[model samples]
Target: MARKIGLYGILAYVVYGLFFYWYLFYFADSSLQFEYEGSKADPATFLNGRELMLTEEYSKIRNLLFFLSTPFEWLFYLFILLLGFGNAFKKWAENSSKFKFVRTAIYLFWLSLFAFIATTPLNYISYSLSKSYNISTQSFSSWMKDELIDFWINFGMMIIIVAVLYWLINKSRKRWWLYAWLLSVPFTLFMMFLQPVVIDPLYNDFYPLKNKELETKILNLADKAGIPAEHVFEVNMAEKTNALNAYVNGIGSNSRIVLWDTTLNRLSDDQILFIMAHEMAHYVEKHIYFGIAGYLLLSLVGLYLTAKLMEYVIGKWGNALRIPAVNDIRSLPLFLMILSMLLFISSPLSNFVSRYQESRADHYAIEMTQNTEAAIGTFQELTRAGLSQVNPPLLVKIFRYGHPTMLERISMLEDYEINNKAKTNE
Candidate 1:
């Protein structure tokens, strides 16, 4: 009976995850659905559905997510570290392995601590994990610089957010969530504006575009598309590593064509032209607007759920804190844990949406470039530069990868080209 109950509990978790999303995807009216064409008549139109949804949804998600996510995310991190330690110990004991449980525990303890203090994870994770590969550009000092900057910024931001939210919730207990939500909107907007503007700069150097010839070529493309040429710029990506990349970020004044230094260094002039054309495709599609909209929709729903759920959860932790306020710092761990669970449950769905968008972008990139050979070459170089696993396990890739593996993308591109050629020959 006990074993049966355990199995049912496991089954229930899986069912809850699936049912929650089925309700969202099936019942939800996110007509924000999109289709990508190789050569769109108006590139900006690709993101029409998404753009329509952005402002409406953005308001709901940003506030709700920040509040819900703030309390639970950190706790999830602790859970993972503990689980990893426990697993490592179990393995060590089974074989009496070279590294005993005690030693293993010590190693994980120190590495996680150093990783925490040095902040060399996330964006530079490739550097830490790619030690065996030829592609990583992270040195200890460089890693430390990334780690420290990230730690202070996040740590300081959390301290302020928690303090302020606690203060507000104390004063407005009956309907404090509404005011908190409103206050959070400006904070979210500030993050959207300042994150890429201020926070991004602290990590990677940004500069105005140079190389008049290359700039001119990009400018002409923008002009042809009716996108202002002055909006495009270059950032110094070469200082850290030789990995080529580019993307379009923001809308209006924030919107700009950002080219990584490595991209300029690696690709031929024509290749760069093709790459920029692909990026222009995204700008033309208005993807950012819709993307933000999707985020808002997800948040509003999540926030409603969180406020009710958090009150119940926080009430328990509140009794323990002797502080009736919902923003007790001691309960931070519990909230973070809940958020982590929420994210874990949502991970598969998030990846599904991301994968769909990425596929559309890839299709647009190829169509705008109209250069299959160049596209292939660019992807190949990127795969090598980033040391991408071309054939990652399907389950692994599905959960973790936002973009299709290089092999899958290359295969699709090749098929498209072959089909087009057959028609041409006919």
Candidate 2:
């Protein structure tokens, strides 16, 4: 019964992909319109309040990928397949007359290496495409350099993480998933510590926010929020990619607000402060801890059930294909691709977790700063720079959006301000 259900799970993935592709092409709009001063009755119509538009159509399409949804869906799907199949294939290779564990290991190593290389080109392509349109400062070479840096850094990290995960699973015969997640807390902590100060610097230059007055205001806001210190920083994210993003990353000394230079260049000081305050809400509320905790719990369940069936699936089908080792380097792409598919299917749940936290932070930021106009302007600037989809489909937003759209956020702010005025008038 478990095997049958597992097979169905895999099959459901394919069917879902076909459905989403159809939906994306047929129904998803290329442009989004937002009202800054008013709202449309339709939930599908996102309102801000201004008469101005926040995004161009192409940007809408692009943002529909990346931050909202992956543009390279196939690539993501194939990655998962390789990871799932490789380990199970190992046991089969063990039993095979011609296959050996060394061969399997070699296969996996190459598969991972090649898979990383192939997907890497798209990293450059995204930047190049933007530059060609005269929207980006990045040259192909510059983007490639950043891509190579990220590739090496993430590739090395992957090997270590994979080794740790496999070890926990391999050593513990039963309930390995539980053990793996239990240990992942420290691993997550290490990542939080290292990401801003270490991993990020390789790809983008991190510097102190240049505007002293703005920085001081942010620091005061942080102090008001009960954070110990303030180290406002800016990064040259536009030098690599044009995506406008801001995040509250790190813990303690490593803690800081990382704003993309594009974000700084586009938003006003007040708007920037609002954005910073919103990011602080995440740290103040400890959203990252909750996020990691949730992921670990999910990973425990997903990896355990999936890993168990992997052996049977590979033995029955993978070996029959005459592929001696499913874990071969060539197969690495496929494995990762498959895992991404499962994750994609699981996206709605993941996105819900992210959206809830982001929304909470948005509300917190509004409360902390009490600057609805700044918040509205910040949302508008981000929408214009990032080319956000104003009102995405319910399912898509629930599944894809890591943060609420400019239209959604600004509308919430607009309503609050309007209500506050009405109360005062009363």
Candidate 2, residue 46: the lDDT equals: 38
TM-scores, in order shown?
0.67, 0.77
lDDT of 1 by residue, 1-426 (tens): 324433554565456545534443344332221332232211232334443243224322322232333223343334433334334433444455453334333333433444364333343443544433433465768767876776677656765655565566567755655665666666766677666577788888777777888888888878876777584567876766656788877555666688998888888777787778777766677766666666665555554555566678546534432323344333333344455566656767778887777777778767766788787777766655664444444444555677776656766777778888998999
Candidate 1 weakest ten by summed lDDT: 36-45
lDDT of each: 0.58, 0.64
Candidate 2 — which residues are off by over 4 angstroms? Answer: 1-22, 29-56, 63-109, 121-125, 133-135, 165-173, 241-243, 321-338
Give candidate 2's error at residue 252 in angstroms. 3.3
Lowest-scoring 10 consecutive residues by lDDT in candidate 2? 40-49
- Relative to the true structure, candidate 2 reaches a TM of 0.77
What lDDT score is found at residue 230 in candidate 1?
Answer: 87
Query: What lDDT is reached at residue 233 by model 2?
Result: 84
Error of 1 at 209 (Å): 2.8
In candidate 2, position 371 carries an lDDT of 86
